[model samples]
Target: MLKRVIQQFQLDVLATSEVEDSHSSTVYKCTLSNGENVYLKIPFTKLKYQRELEAYEILKGKVSIPEMINYWSGDEECPGAFLLSELKGKPLTSAAKPTTAFQVGVLHAKMHSTQPPSEQVLNGMKNEFPNWSHFIDQQFYSFAEDAKYILDERLYQKAIEKFERMKQQLPLSDGPSFIHMDFRPANIIVDNEQVSGVIDFESVRFGSTEVDFSKLYRDFLSYDSSLYSAYQRGYNSIRPLIDLEKVLPFYRFTDAFNSIGWCKRRGNQEHALFLEENLARLKKWLL
Candidate 1:
């Protein structure tokens, strides 16, 4: 089905679109007859495929995002939807920069400015996951028991307790906006020191604008203070100041829980370790 679709699209050479490490889908890169580069993503499930396609359509041309050219439904032979989009530059993870952090901050600010079609669409886009306590009790702790040896139970329990207490004292905001729930460095593309494009809209949902920045801060700024400062400068250039102290704990907790899930599914020891370390850090922050 993919081959036929590529042929129908008049593609010349199918570049390496082999599966990446994502647990979701099989992604491919194809070059068309006119030297146009395109990415084909086929998810493991029908729901995910539909969600990603909807997200791509919603996000197309709103910000610096790759253009979706076509979508193909799967028959018994294909078994999944096919997403075709123009291949853009490298992700920010590969193209490190002193300004990458700031670029992301600004990008996110712009993304939040675009209003979705309805409040329902906006609500659907928000991270629907519960707060840290529920996430730990239902998700992380269960996973830790399943992967006992890989996790630090004491630290996990401490972090969970801390999160529950901190959640009450944390500041609350009712100003909801479009959030790229997985706004991390790897999903951002850069060229000539500018963000050429943003990719991976699967996690695109409506929620607290801060939810989007959380992943960015955890993935990039936590490693380098200078980058965090630079990112703030860029972000503040567009929007006003954001209270990092209020948001950092939530961001760390979210990232830690996500990392734990990743390690459990993929059996990645490094990710598990990172999860533990982040959990400990969150605990200290809450304390």
Candidate 2:
């Protein structure tokens, strides 16, 4: 498949190595004959491919994301692929300084403030939900439904009860803004203690900016109080930060529930740890 893509797109002679193969896509780091590096991404499904392409178009100029270099729309038998300019940085890690966390917040704030999609852009979006609240409702219920058989019977019922409570308590969404549904440390890039870029847009959608913070808080910001403070400062610099006390718990619970569902559906051995982690979280919240 890689060779076919290279020949069809006439990518320059290069060396390549697999970078990540998530449920959504497989990515490769390709070193060009001239030593320049780029990313080649092949989404596992047509829907995922289309989502990322649409997101890139919508997010351009407003966010620091990978630049699209080349693309091939796939046919029924083959999934298509695209090339992106290599971002220079490692994925954001716990070791990153508070400065990097601040930049991460700045990135989210900028994304949230992005202009609503133009009518023409909306026409092209196949995945836009009616509103942020609708999207969250769908996500929460969908994950809960999938988790029914996978979770312990008593635990699953308890989770459903908690889900209902959260469903009722969730606040009004802030905007019809661009949101990276998977915004977390691994999707953010850090260079010299500064956030340099964000990647992985296959889950991007038009939703409440508040929904985007759940995963970031679960995986990054919640780990350090000082870092969280810095992040709030940066976000407030651009736009007012959401009242985390009111929203974070609801979103975080849903996020963890979604992780369990994802792991259950994918059924990868590697997902065992994630499954256990979310199970622990759910137990802590519900039991």
Candidate 3:
């Protein structure tokens, strides 16, 4: 079906291979007749496809994100997907140097610096929530409800109590900057030790930079102190990150719980248990 769609589109597909095969979507790298490379994102659900499209539209010019070559919606026989010009370089991996984290930090700050029309477009999504805090509050309760059986009740309750207290002490910021929302090394492509492009913006929206940074810290920085400090140096150089004391901790805890809930949902027992065993490790960040 995908092949037919490509042929019908008059694309001279020189060669094609699966680049990323994930639950949500399967991205194919296509080498066109003209020798130009592009990626096609075919999501499992319509919602993910739509999310990807919206993200590209809202963010194409805001930062060093991929450019949309075409947003294709096929007829009844065919399907819909996005064709994006290939981003330069490879994914940042475990082999990356600490300096790569700093480069990512700099790019993140630059992305956050994007204001106005771009932020408006991104943040304007899902207006059902009053604000960022409201959106997070709703998610937190939802996470607790979903993980109640999977996690220890007392530990979960303690987490809620701590979070509620922190919420009261934390000051909420007005208006959001465009945040990648899923900022991390794997989503970042680096070339010559510099950030070339950022992918996986399906979760992109108008939100706090703190939440974005928290995911990075939770994923890699917690283990590598050098990476953490370098990232801080890179980020702080562009713009001072806000809400570090009260708000950042909330995001850190949220990332852990969210990961656990998602892993359990996917029946990924190994990862879920890994998250559970290391749950206590997130406490330092919580306080």
Candidate 4:
């Protein structure tokens, strides 16, 4: 695969090492003969590949992201590949300080404030919907179908009822904005406490800005209220923060529910722990 990528992109590679933590794609850290370092990513699915390429093209100057150096649409023997300029620094971990979260918040605020160049660009992204509620409706019911068997009868019914109630009570989306659907510490690159770049554009989309916060809160912010407050402060420094308190519970619940359904569909024992975790989350939400 690396040899073919090198030939197709005409890259002079000196050495390459695989990134072990890349779950949805095969990523390689390639050091070129001329001393430039780049990432060669080949996504496992066509959807992810298309989203990443479109995101890079549309967000070239609007956001701080890895540069897309070159790309190849694969044939029968190979899959599509993207050669991206390396974003410096390590992935932000749980140990990162409140200041780092503030930086991430500022970066995220910039993304949320950016409007697509035109309706054509907005419609081109595969993940856009009419509004926040529409997206949630689609996701909740579809995931419910996948997770029906995973949850007991009482819990499943409670989830349905909760979604219906949430639909009536949730506020209208502020407006369509560019969002990193999977924004989290792992996708954020930081050097010496400053965010250098954000990576993993496969989930980029035009949608509700508030929904983007669900994953970050679930995996990071919930651990420390101080971090959350600092993040909100940073975001408000750029633009006013949304009424997050009103919508967070609903978004967080849906995010957890989606994870459970995704794990069940993957049908791997390796996902057992994740499945159990989301199941517990659902029960808590339903209660």
- Report the poorest 10 consecutive residues by lDDT, candidate 4: 120-129
lDDT of 1 by residue, 1-287 (tens): 56766665555773656645455677777765577667777776666666677676666677778776767766666645554665356667633666866787778777776555564343224343334235334544565554444446775566566656766665664234566667777777777677876776655654556556667766677787777887788778877655878876666675565556566666666465655665565555544
Ranking by TM-score: 2, 4, 3, 1
TM-score of 1: 0.78
Highest TM-score: which candidate? 2
Per-residue lDDT for 57 in model 1? 63
Question: How large an RMSD does model 4 have?
Answer: 2.1
Overall local distance difference test of candidate 1 = 0.63
lDDT of 2 at 268: 37
RMSD of each: 4.1, 1.7, 3.6, 2.1
Candidate 2, position 211, lDDT: 75
Angstrom error of the Cα, residue 142, model 2: value is: 1.9
Top lDDT prediction, candidate number: 4
Task: Provide the TM-score for each candidate, comma-separated.
Answer: 0.78, 0.94, 0.81, 0.91
Task: Return the lDDT, model 2, position 89.
Answer: 84
Question: In candidate 1, how many Å is residue 40 off?
Answer: 0.8
Q: Write the per-residue lDDT of candidate 2 for residues 1-287, one digit (tens) a residue.
A: 88877776787856999886355788888888888898888988777888888878888898999999888998776678998997888888777678877888899899888755666454324434455566666777787777886788998888778878877876666776777788888888888887888898777777677778887888788889988998998899899887888889888888888888888788837789889999899889987
Judged by lDDT relative to the true structure, which candidate is superior, 1 or 4? 4
Residue-wise lDDT of candidate 3 within 44-159, one digit each (tens)?
Answer: 65555666777677666666778887777655643467778877888876566778888787888877876535244533244322476787787778767766666677777777
